[model samples]
Target: MSCSEDPTCQELLDHIYELVDADEDAIDERSRALLAAHAAVCPSCRDAVDAERHVRELLRRCCGESVHAPAALRVRVVSMTTRVRRTE
Candidate 1:
């Protein structure tokens, strides 16, 4: 069951980040369907989606294919930051 009768442009835009990170999370099927349908007819949204996809791809390629840090590295970084304070 979809929350919205049809995904509005605003709704799609708001969730665009989720769409870009689609593989990272299980976005609902209804929302995914709506995004696909809307992008087909909405040039603005299609362009935005394309740009977001491109940026994500580039980042993946440049960052060695994983957007997230490896678990071991993350643990080390977190421990090191325990005493560091953010200045900005």
Candidate 2:
């Protein structure tokens, strides 16, 4: 099944950045484990998570270790995720 058709994929996408980011507490452990398990079995989800990590690493390298997301960006991200969840 394609990623687009998989609810797990939607979950992955919705939390992709959190899953790959350095913040370990961004998600609860159980939810994180579920996402990790799904990514392990779903190549598409794995790739998406990997890509997010890669981008994060690239940003850190280019912008320094102190690289941080702007507050506005965080707001927008939360808004986007909320909209996605509402649609589902």
Error of 1 at 88 (Å): 25
Query: Cα RMSD (Å) per model?
Result: 7.7, 5.2
Model 1 per-residue lDDT tens digits across residues 1-88: 2326577787778677667676334367777777778878999999989998998788888987546878999678756654352331
Alpha-carbon runs more than 4 Å astray in model 1: 1-3, 23-26, 70-88
Compared with the true structure, all predictions reach lDDT values of 0.72, 0.74
In terms of TM-score, how similar is model 1 to the real structure? 0.65
Error of 2 at 46 (Å): 0.4
lDDT of 2 at 22: 30
lDDT of 2 by residue, 32-75 (tens): 77778899999999888888888877888999987778999989
Deviation in angstroms for 68 in model 1? 2.5
Query: What's the distance in Å from true for residue 61, model 1?
Result: 1.4
Error of 1 at 57 (Å): 0.8
Model 1 steric clash pairs: none
Candidate 1, overall lDDT?
0.72
